[model samples]
Target: MKIAIIGCGNMGLAFARAFLKFDLVKKEDFLLVEKGEDRMEKLSSFQPGVITGVIGPQIGTYDLIILSVKPQDFPSVQEALRAVITPNQVVLSIMAGVTIANIQTVLDHKAVIRAMPNTPAMLGMGITAYTASPEVDMTQLRKVENLINATGRSVFLEEEEQLNAVTALSGSGPAYFFYVVKAMIEAGKKMGFEESVAALLVKQTMLGSFHLINTADKSLDELIKAVASKGGTTEAALKQFEAGNLDETLIGGILAAQMRSKELSKG
Candidate 1:
């Protein structure tokens, strides 16, 4: 299938690389539209059969198109694509906040899909949340899912509105994980370790904890209880966390993120 990527930014390049890595689409079937000369040079070095030129060439005559441009540039993108994309072509938008209905309005009622993917997609470990309208059939939806699944795992949302929650969770989730790692590292240092030692400990601890969570059949609270024996150091830390209402704080943070996502989409 012919595929075109409009932005060639990090996410776009990531998807392109995953596509090439899996041999899902032939090199000749892909076209990249990038304005940055240096970045374009980088893409050329990858030896993918990517035509770096006007969006018009790439937008027209493509079976599938990935819209990865910045949200602010979408007006010009819509204007550029109005006469080019046929009803048969599908538009998969990876922009954070844009909705499928808004995209279809721009493309004159063409098939449109919205997807939210995070930074880990560059490493093929991201989870993408996508939704499609009635314009897409089950077969077409699976085709899109297959392409997205190349980058990482994917989930379909029945209600398009839940994309906001997806944005708050997986979309911004990587940074949250990193933030936790940072806090762990800092706490380690405060407890009298060298910076490098603390970093390594935190990293390995996180990895091990992740493996334990995956392998263990116990619920998270039960696992925590297992570690926090009565009146032990772990129990003391848990008490502190409970005193500070960490759960409430986390819920507030996620809600804030969801609100910001809604604001971006409205913009």
Candidate 2:
């Protein structure tokens, strides 16, 4: 199928690379649009066979259009393609806070799908949560799933409202993990290890813990209990975290993100 991707920025490039890697779409069948000359040059050098151009009349010919532009840039993009987008074409958007209704209103098209994808997509290890407009058919939805799954995994939501929560959780979740790892590395350094060594230790520990959680049959709580024995160091740290209300604070922060996402959708 012919697919066109607008905005060849980091996330856009990630999707392109993932799609190409999985053979979901052929390079020759894909169109990469970027306004910046330098970026267009870079994309062309990376995939010479792929069609590259600035946004123009040619976008109307594609069966699918993937909107990867920034949320703030949507208005201009909408205006540019509003006259060309047909109801038969499916529009898949990855811009955070740009709701399905917003796209339909702005672009005057109903077959839209809004998705929340994380930075892990860059490595083809991300999870995406998506919801589609009622006008989208099952075949189009399945195609979107296949394209998104090439990045890693994808889930469909019946209600579009859940996308705000997904945006808060997985969409911004990578930064949360990195923040904790930063603290761990700092703690290790304070305990007398060199910076590089502390980083290595913390990174490996985090990776190993993630692997264990994924492969182990036990629930998360069970694994936590296994690690934190009564009166042990892990228990001591857990107690400190509980006393400081760390979990509550983290949840509050995520909710705040969700609220911000909702507010942005209004714009």
- lDDT comparing candidate 2 with the true structure: 0.89
Deviating ranges (above 4 Å) for candidate 2: 48-53
User: Would you list the clashing residue pairs of candidate 1?
Assistant: none
> Who wins the lDDT comparison?
2
lDDT tens readout by residue for model 1, 75-177:
8677778877788888899887788878887779568889999888888888999999888888888988998988889999998889999999899898989
TM-score, candidate number 2: 0.94
RMSD of 1: 1.7
- Model 1 stretches with alpha carbons more than 4 Å out: none
Candidate 1 at 12: error in angstroms? Answer: 1.1
What are the Cα lDDT values of the candidates? 0.86, 0.89
Q: Which ten residues in a row have the lowest lDDT in candidate 2?
A: 48-57
Model 2, 120-210: lDDT tens digits are 9999899999999989999999988999998888999998888989999999999999999999999999999999999999999999999
Error of 2 at 47 (Å): 1.3
